[model samples]
Target: MSAAEVSVRRRRGSFGRLFASEVHLVFGRRRNQVGLLVLFGLVTMLGVALKVSAMRHPGDRGGDLFSLVAGNGVFLGFAGLTIEIALFLPLAVSVLAGDAVAGEANLGTLRYLLVAPVGRGRLLVVKACALGVGALTGAVLVALAGVLVGVLLFGAGPLITLSGSQIGLGDGLLRLLLAALYVAVGLAALGMIGLFISTLTEQPIAATVATAMVSTLLWILDAVPQLDWLHPWLLVDRWSAFIDLLRDPVFTDRMVTGLWVDIAYGAVFLFAAWLRFRVKDITS
Candidate 1:
């Protein structure tokens, strides 16, 4: 191969190695492993509870699937997603993202890693990819566990929507996956926020708490009765809007808005982090 071709191939290989190393570092820890196990366990418990509840109230199938169990097996994914989007999944992501940089610096590994043959920008990119992978994995695990348990316990059938519309099993499963994707995207933005905070301190725990506290505060502000003006622009304002996908006609305005909001946040925060880390004085 020509020199140019060889250069491109080498770059690709280097990035692949970087990404693999980053993923290993992020998830190889005991705490991260336990966190993932806890997430799956909680979702599993939720599925069992929903199955029992459905059996107890066979004639009480009501409410939208996204917000309630609705006594239907197919809707169980939405039920689990509803809980995860608000807390569990995001918390898992925050723990990883918050430690991406600060944890390495605290352990006195950041300086050594920088001494390797990788650029700072590329290092940040690999870290972001690792965080995204973790967030997406957490999301898919909840959905998959919910679906598996939901089908086994309650049995799968047509999905009933909020508008009293029935969706076929195939289409229902597809929509469920889309809803999970939406949750993953929203959590990715939160991961960026954690990454940004990680750049500001050497204490991973502090960064994690700060990220979670900021997210909780945003949720609180979104709920205030008089924060109407800020509601439209808040990061968590449209997280649950993924439920619109379940509509017969598919109301996508909110989902579209939510995606753009996530994109904007991801861009702004990731850039800020890169800028900070690029000039940071690593004394550790």
Candidate 2:
């Protein structure tokens, strides 16, 4: 290969290695491991409760099992998701995203990394990607645990959607996957917001706490009856839009709006992080 070809290959190899390293670091952290374990534990506990409900109230026509699980075994994943999206998963995402840049800066590694072959832009991209993967991994684990327990306890069968439509098991699973994907995408905006906050401070703990507080505040704001006008524009407003995926017709209106909302939040925060990191002094 020519010198140019060799250079291109080397650069690609390095970028790939960098990404892999970031992923490893993100997942290997004790906090991330604990976060994942907590999600699994929550799902498992919920599965047990659901199983008990199904047993004792087997004759009951209407209950949480029907509304949440939709009278299908696979819909149990949806039930787990319903409980998780409210707080559990968002907390996990915040942890990784908040620590992404600030952690490195706190450890006094950010300055050296910038001075090294890693460009500031590349570093930010890597951190953001790692944070995204961490968030998505949490979502996947919750879904997997929910399905495994649900299948063992409830048994897999036809999926009954919210609109009284019956779908095949395969289609149900597909919808569940889409729902999880949508959730991951939605939480990614939170990750971006945390990433921006991480850039603003050298203390990782401060960033993490700030992100969590912001998320809590958003949840509180979303709950206020008088805040109806702000609901559409709030970050957490469209998070539950994933529920539409479980519907028979697969309502795209809220899903599309949520996607765009997530994109807008991510784009704005990412730009802010980039702008701040571009000129900010890194003495630590």
User: Which numbered prediction scores highest in lDDT against the true structure?
Assistant: 1
- True lDDT of residue 85, candidate 2: 89
Candidate 2 residues lying further than 4 Å off, grouped into runs, are 1-7, 63-70
Q: Per-prediction TM-score, please? A: 0.94, 0.94
lDDT tens digits, residues 37-140, model 2? Answer: 89999888887877787677775656343345525567678878888987888888878876788888999988877877877887888888887887788777
Query: Cα miss at 162, model 1 (Å)?
Result: 2.0
Encode model 1's per-residue lDDT on 1-284: one tens digit a residue: 89999998988899999899889977798899999888878877887776677667666655656335544566777778888777788788889987899999999999998998888988998888898898888888788877887777777888877666888889988988888888888888999999999999999999898888878888899989798899988889999997887788888999999999998998899999999999998999
Stretches > 4 Å off in candidate 1: 64-70
Question: Model 1: C-alpha RMSD to truth?
Answer: 1.7
Write out the backbone clash pairs for model 1.
Answer: none
